[model samples]
Target: MTATRAPQGQEETRAGLWARLGDRLIVGGATVGDHGRDGEIVGLHHGDGTPPYDVRWSDTGRVTLVFPGPDARVQHFAPHAGPSAVRQS
Candidate 1:
């Protein structure tokens, strides 16, 4: 629900985001929001009640989060490239 901007000339990488999320889940035992991808920590609500969060990428290349459950469905739209693929206009 809050937004923080990255430093100038600095950008977040997907691997870094994933690592951060993994570390947070492992250490904090709570969910977190991935600002880079706009994903939320849906919490583990299945076996251990730590439901896995889903990442939904938008057409504009932005990503969002989806809570776990029957409502959470993976929808693949396009193939995402690495940071190398992001070229400034």
Candidate 2:
């Protein structure tokens, strides 16, 4: 069988995004609570090279808040899986 090659640079992009998000969340005064806890990652998108994802959190089916930042900021938060929503905040 022939060996399959993975996509080039995709991993790097993802890593970069993750780092950016982590840094921004730290700087923006956001904290990551329990994964299956009270809140959920409700949104994600590419921000202009600063924070990539405009993450939203919800508790009890109501949107509690939104976190928008530089593209780098959102990248780190993109790994979460849940309902999708975007709000400018």
Candidate number achieving the greatest lDDT relative to the actual structure: 2
lDDT of 1: 0.32
Candidate 2 is scored at a TM of 0.24
Candidate 2 per-residue lDDT over residues 1-89, each given as its tens digit? 99765575343333343433322232233455523323333333544333333333333455433444432133233333222333347
Q: Name model 2 segments beyond 4 Å from true.
A: 1-13, 16-38, 47-58, 68-89
- For each candidate in the order shown, give its overall lDDT on alpha carbons: 0.32, 0.35
**Tens digits of per-residue lDDT for model 1, 1-89:** 88887765554333212221211121121345522322323233344323354333432444344443432322211123332344589
Best by TM-score: 2
Minimum summed lDDT over a 10-residue window in model 1 is located at 20-29
Task: Count clashing residue pairs in model 2.
Answer: 17
